[model samples]
Target: MSKDYLSVMPEDFSDFGLSQPILKAIDQSGYTEPTPIQTQMIPSVMEGRDVIGQAQTGTGKTAAFALPLLNGLRQKKKASPQILVLAPTRELALQVADSFKKYGTYINNLKVLAIYGGEEYSGQLRQLSKGVNIVVGTPGRVMDHIRRGSLKLDTIQSFILDEADEMLKMGFLEDVEWILEQAPQQKQIALFSATMPSSIRRIAATHLHDPVEITIRSKTATASTINQKFLITNGMNAKKEALGRILEVSETDGVLTFVRTKMQTVELAEFLTELGYQAAPLNGDIPQNQRLRTVEQLKSGKIDILVATDVAARGLDVERVSHVINFDIPFDTESYIHRIGRTGRAGRTGEAILLLAPREKSMLKSIERASRRKIEMMHMPSVNEVNKKRIEAYKSRITKTLTEDCSFFDDLIRDYCSETEASVEQVAAALAKLVQGNSPMLLEEKKYERREKRERKQPVGGRNNRRSSGRSDEGMERYRIAVGESHGVKPGNIVGAIANEVDMDSEYIGRISIYDEYSTVDLPAGMPRQLMKVLHNARINGRMMKLSREGEKSSGSERFGNRKNGGKPRRSNPKTSRKPRTASAV
Candidate 1:
């Protein structure tokens, strides 16, 4: 239902029957009205019904559930967790838990805890022992707590699974199912997914009962109000210069710059701050309190620029964000969408600019395909253009000062001009020069290269793709490993572990034969001593291979007892016989 951009949002939150405290919190959150997902899903969830909310990433689903859950906190009072929320990632867990705390600020005796990996257990333990009203965490960590008998779900009134589809994609479906089984039968269940695949549907069928289904799909991954553009930058130097130029010319009110790593966030923020933009770095390592403070600063216009990672910026809904600059492209299209969605939110018009290196053209194509909009190339600002912008800004500042009461500065400048033999304009020019530090007001022109052509002409195969580097065409050598059927080792397992260690392709693997207690395989001759030594400790299915060249007594035919059966045709290498189809099917 949210897909229709023409739909009118709710007039107010009172219509949803939320509590006064929640209303106050929402007011503080600056959400004047509810999004479509919130409008449709809030009332149903408030009534304590099973809900299946299907919505895209930017539909404000977190608040839709968080508000109602907090509103009913008094209905079932318990020191144990009354609400259990499962997210696919720790970052999401942190964000959702923060929201619950924000919405429940006025609700007395309310306590929430976020438990996830990459954290010390002592803090989480202390919070749980002290008593908590809600527990939000990733599935794996939740399972850990359950098995350790630290997290109890018997008193849970509400169980929420956020981003069900993401969990499924990340191979956590089984873990989710197991956790659902642990919840109390009397609890209300809510499952949310962006796209309901068969696995997620099966989960809903198995756990949720008579759920009210809600779906929100936008026409495009990004709002049409967002003007998207890309700049072809060749490397870090060019990309940095391009970023400075773009911000110099573009409308940069509350700009959010996305980078790939935590280190990049700090480095780029420092760079931008040096360039005179008030920028802050945000990443996972920052304390949660500090992170929240940083977010509030950005929201309140205390800072004009925020450089953040995808995880750090997830679920941010700041209306002041006027632009999103992708300093480093995301690994997936979903992340790309989430990154740009920081701007152009709440039906507001915004700009999104992406910097692309030559090697990232394919990723650019993927993003274009996913966003379903043509991202036109950006025009790099010339030296003359930068100078013009600087001049305009300078004149505008001077005009504003003239409008204000600057009598103190005016008298001082007049006295100085009289003492020296200088005109008023010359004195003003000298002050302007002093105000403008050593940093140049304008940037020198930098040339941009079209590296896409070179990228396209590059060949694919390299030494990394080889199964065995420097393996001569003469013949092969037979090797033996002390792992086989008895140890539950399969040919495919052997092939995978060895190939992965050397960054090789599996298709080029040679013949393999497995016995009850051991296995023999033919490999390219003249194996490097270093590679052989590394392979000695290569493990498969938790058992070290202890790999070594056969004692040179066993021939290929003698190793395979079923040679008469002729299991299968060998790899297409000219020097080999039929490769036995023992267990290398994978």
Candidate 2:
């Protein structure tokens, strides 16, 4: 039977009958009350019953499972993976393993290892030989270890699947099934997914035994202290320009900017440095120790801006990160939530600004629904506004100098005035010119005014007086890709890959529809063969999508863009404003 929870939560972890050790760790984490997911999930897992959770990302699901699992852990002398956690990505595997280690810190004789494909196998092999109570890994690497006889599942007491639906979408359903069969001796199975698709449901039915299902239906809203906002920016140049102006006008001590790719982190950081902001780039390629040092610098105010990707910025908690700027729109609401979460710490108000083009505006609604808050439209910071801010700061500097003991400078200036017979005002004006250097005290407004005029004249939904791929689209034409719903592809993956490969703004892309065997996308109605070749070779979900015109042979020559149900378009990725499906958030 299925169970759902929408009631008042307990105020403390002690109410869940947790062990003293687990309770102590919870207290150290500064969590005074249990989240909705933790409140609903802890009791079931403590009862040793299988659980299936329907939660969206950012609902505190990790702690929900980790706390209960740690509370019941019985450290054995010969640890051979008493509990197994299968994740979709190596990054998640590491995160989950870290949580396990943290929560179980008070327990004696506890060991955890995160195994994935890219890392060296010798290290993993050494860990396994040393004996670990918990083994968290990706499906492929786990399967490899199982085949190599390094990982044995007969001793596993519980098996957990984190983000089961994501694994299915990433084409890991078969691998997950194989892992499940290998652990038939496991006592209970815990499956967590954002949504309950038919495939996931089938696996739950086949694997779990009389499970207690829990769903946290509460509105997953962002922190009320954050002022969520968005800017309608088109081309890359426009985004960079807007960023500089916001940085100048915003009341921020430190800013964290997120981008989609590592290359963008470097490029945007360099651009910000050129515009007179102390900025640095952070990505996964950077060593772990260096990443920590960079975060430390941000906290100490040595650098005011840090350009980073999602993975690099994970678990970053800095009280001074007052602003989070999304230089590029995130493909999913979960990522949007994670990005903004870096700020709004230590009871201070935070600001999250999303930069969106005309085409990417559709994602705005998804982010709002997931966050359960309205992101008000933010006016582009005008040149006049920037000038006013600079003038204030300049005057403050002058006031500070006047308060200091300037006796020697005053005497020297008096001597100069007497020698030249110039008035004190004239001498002060010359000194002010020296302080200002060659640059004007106020920002020039002519270029900004001309750009505003051009923006006002541009047509709706077109790039703001800028072409995306160095060419303007006359109109849109429908095209088909070899990937489809069967391949577990989403529209954002299609849009992200296309926009990145061609260096074009997402605003040029049009409506998309996913079908059973193939998908349809609307692109610029063009006759360029070279660009077509580049797109044709683009891969999605590790499969080369043979992108071709609609009604092509590779598309099965069937025009099903309009389905039998009233000839309407069906976009399946973005969820409705009511119930969100992602549950990977902390």
Compute each candidate's TM-score over C-alphas. Answer: 0.69, 0.72
- For all candidates in order, the CA lDDT equals 0.76, 0.77
Question: Considering summed lDDT, which 10 consecutive residues are worst modelled in model 1?
Answer: 460-469
Can you write out model 1's per-residue Cα lDDT over 199-223, one digit (the tens) per residue?
Answer: 8999888888888887765624346
Candidate 1, residue 503: CA error in Å?
19
Per lDDT, the best of the predicted structures is 2
Error of 2 at 82 (Å): 1.7
- For 493-583, candidate 2 gives per-residue lDDT tens digits of 8888777776544665665656655666667554244456677788998877778877564533544333554333233355543322111
Please give the distance, in angstroms, between residue 229's alpha carbon in candidate 1 and its true position after superposition.
2.5
Alpha-carbon lDDT of model 1: 0.76
